[model samples]
Target: MDDKDLELLRILEENSRLSAQEIGSMTNLIPAEVEARIHALEESRIIRKYTTVINWEKAGNGEVSAIIELKVSPERDFGYDRIAERLSRFRQVRTLRLITGTYDLQLMVSGKNVQEVSRFVSEHVAPMDRIRETATHIVMKSYKENGNTLFEQQEAERLPYSF
Candidate 1:
């Protein structure tokens, strides 16, 4: 990707709602050109889904969040992919990662309460054929969850000090 594409991505990452004209203004490109480049980016799957970052606490839905580490039976006889696919379908699962170390998979889960989360792990996750053991850590509060892309745009748009 060229510098223009990188700039476009930066803008879109901050706010996907920005119009092609608005993006064009920021990048000094014509609206049509901006539109075409955006189209190309989308078609190439470079720009995936546009999403909103909601503060669950402010929304009054924040109850609890947990990180679960799962140790699964080795995939020599059984396939881990199938298990991962099934785990991914759960509503409470925010993110799942297959990683190295003592654990095979790491899962980020959010629920209304501890009971709800425990039920999900015991009933849904534990019952799986390949799962050997699981460890869970409840999050009290997040110091930093995900970094804000908008901050970069704000910095870029900041005016220089006038002497």
Candidate 2:
């Protein structure tokens, strides 16, 4: 991708609602060129699905979230790939990563409540053959996620001078 393509991607990442004409104005490309380039990017899978970041807590649909660290014994031939693939398929699993740390695999999972999440871990995750140990840390509150601050900083009110 060229510099113009990269610029388009950056603009889209910030706000995917921009029209081709609007993006063209920003990137100095004509609307038709902008549309063609965007199509190419989508076809090549460089531009994946556009997303909206929402604060679920404020929406009143808040769910319990947790980060679970797994100590896993890698499969003989496939290594961590097989286990990672399996974990990714679970509906509750939000994000999964292979990190350089004490844990072999780490996953972010969510559910309606603490009991539901705990039950999922005990019944499904911990009992898996390759999973040797697991550690779950529940997320109590989120100040920022995906680069968006959950709370806005309001200007403090001042009283009239008395002294």
Candidate 3:
């Protein structure tokens, strides 16, 4: 990836809705060049997908999210990659990563409520052959997520109420 490619990525990262012309304006490249660069990025799997970060609370979705840590005895040669691939197939799994720490893997899962999350882990995750142990932590509140501030507790805006 060249400097131009990095610049294009940065521009798109801020706001994916920006047109090629808009990005080209910022990077001094022509619209056609910007489009071609973006296409190449997608083909190379560098730019995975364009996504929207929603304030689920403000939207009144009432969905709950949690971070779960897993300890697994990695399979023969396939190792953690095999276990990770199986976990990725589930719809509830939002994010999963293999980390070097006390635990082997950490997962971010979302569901309607705690019960749903518990059920998913107990039913699916716990039963996995390689998985030795699992720990789940439910999110109480989110101040920020995906680089967007959900709420600022310090800057609480109150409406003037008349009795």
Candidate 4:
């Protein structure tokens, strides 16, 4: 991608709600140009989906988040993709990643309460045929829970010969 595309991505990453005109102003491009660039970015899959970053705690939803490590049986025929697909369908699952370590998969989940999360694990996740064992760590407090970042370009300035 060109410099213009990088700038557009930075702006969109900070706030997807920004209008094409607003983005154009920041990047010194025409509104139509900005629109077309954004469209191209989306088509190329560089810009995925525009989504909201909610403040869960402030929303008065006393929910708890957890990271569940799963140890799965090695695939004999089909593959791990099938098991990953099935687990991904769960509404409580925020993010799932296949990792290289003792565990096969890492899952980020959230629920209304501890009991609700426990129920999800005991009733749903554990019973899955491919799963061997599961370990969970509840999120007590978030120092940074995504979307809390400064997008100012100047903030990333590095002095010459600093390194």
Candidate 5:
């Protein structure tokens, strides 16, 4: 809300692991003040959750990820909210959003492999009452995510090929 609060949020966004004292030092606030502001942010839901963005490939737990666009027939009673909630309940669903676009809903899904993702769409998502169609786009590589670069400099570098 205030300048201090905004600055505090920026600091936390960079590194959530920073201690209250460290954050206070960077933001020019006392440790207690930093703690109070952070608590308020949490209560207000401005800071939903502190999370670590892991590079799954490097960790050797890489999962197949896809961005699926859905064109669904809205229910008469609750419209898209009801359907969105249903999709949210699935474990494969990572992110779901309703936007003003060609599709009614956009979903980011993860699975053990391509087959698993295809199966999820065919067996689970396609079976949903209102779902009319789905277009899946699998993520081949991610250069960056959540403002963090997935690949390091050395890994990105390659020798120039002379023709």
Candidate 6:
């Protein structure tokens, strides 16, 4: 809402683990003020849940992720809101967006394996009445996610040259 609040949000967005005292130091506010502002932000729903991004490959989770594009016929009055709300209830859906593109909606979904994801698409998503078409793309690897790089880049080692 104010400049100090915006500054606090920026700092928290980068690292949510910082203490109110630490945030206060950066924002030039007292710890109590920092805490109160952050609480207000959370109550207003401007600051969503804090999350940690994990490199699941190294964790050995073997999670299968897919990006699904849906072409749909918008309902009369409600437009995409009705369908979007219904789709949001599905546990597999991680992210959903309505964008200016060929498809009306896009969804990010994940499951333990490809079969599970495929079954979700076929049984739950594709059969929906308003959904005209669906395209599912499986993710093979992730180099970066949520502003963090998943892999570390190393300098190439060169062979010794003869005189």
lDDT of each: 0.87, 0.93, 0.93, 0.89, 0.93, 0.95
Can you give the lDDT of residue 41 in candidate 3? Answer: 99
After superposition, the stretches of candidate 2 with alpha carbons farther than 4 Å from their true spots are: 156-163
The superposed Cα distance between candidate 4 and the true structure at residue 44, in angstroms, equals 3.7
Candidate 1: the clashing residue pairs are none
Error of 3 at 103 (Å): 0.7
Report per-prediction Cα RMSD to one decimal.
Answer: 5.9, 2.3, 4.7, 6.5, 3.8, 2.4
lDDT value for candidate 3?
A: 0.93
User: How would you encode candidate 5's per-residue C-alpha lDDT over 123-161 as one tens digit per residue?
Assistant: 999889989999999999888988999988675667899
lDDT of 6 by residue, 26-115 (tens): 988999999999999999999989999999998998999999999999999999999999999999999999977899999999999999
Which candidate leads the pack in TM-score? 6
Where's the lowest-lDDT run of ten residues in candidate 1? 147-156
Listed in order, each prediction's TM-score against the native is 0.79, 0.89, 0.90, 0.81, 0.88, 0.92
Each model's backbone clash number: 0, 0, 0, 0, 0, 0
Candidate 3 RMSD computed on C-alpha atoms after optimal superposition onto the true structure: 4.7
Query: For residues 27-62, could you state the per-residue lDDT of candidate 3 as single tens digits?
Result: 999999999999999999999999998888889999
lDDT of 2 by residue, 38-102 (tens): 99999999997888888888888869999999999999989999999999999999999998789
lDDT of 1 by residue, 61-138 (tens): 857899999999867755577788889999999999999999999999989999999999999998898899999999
Q: Which ten residues in a row are the worst by lDDT in model 2?
A: 145-154
Candidate 1, residue 87: Cα displacement in angstroms equals: 0.7
**Over 4 Å off, model 6:** 155-163
lDDT (C-alpha) at residue 29 in model 1: 100
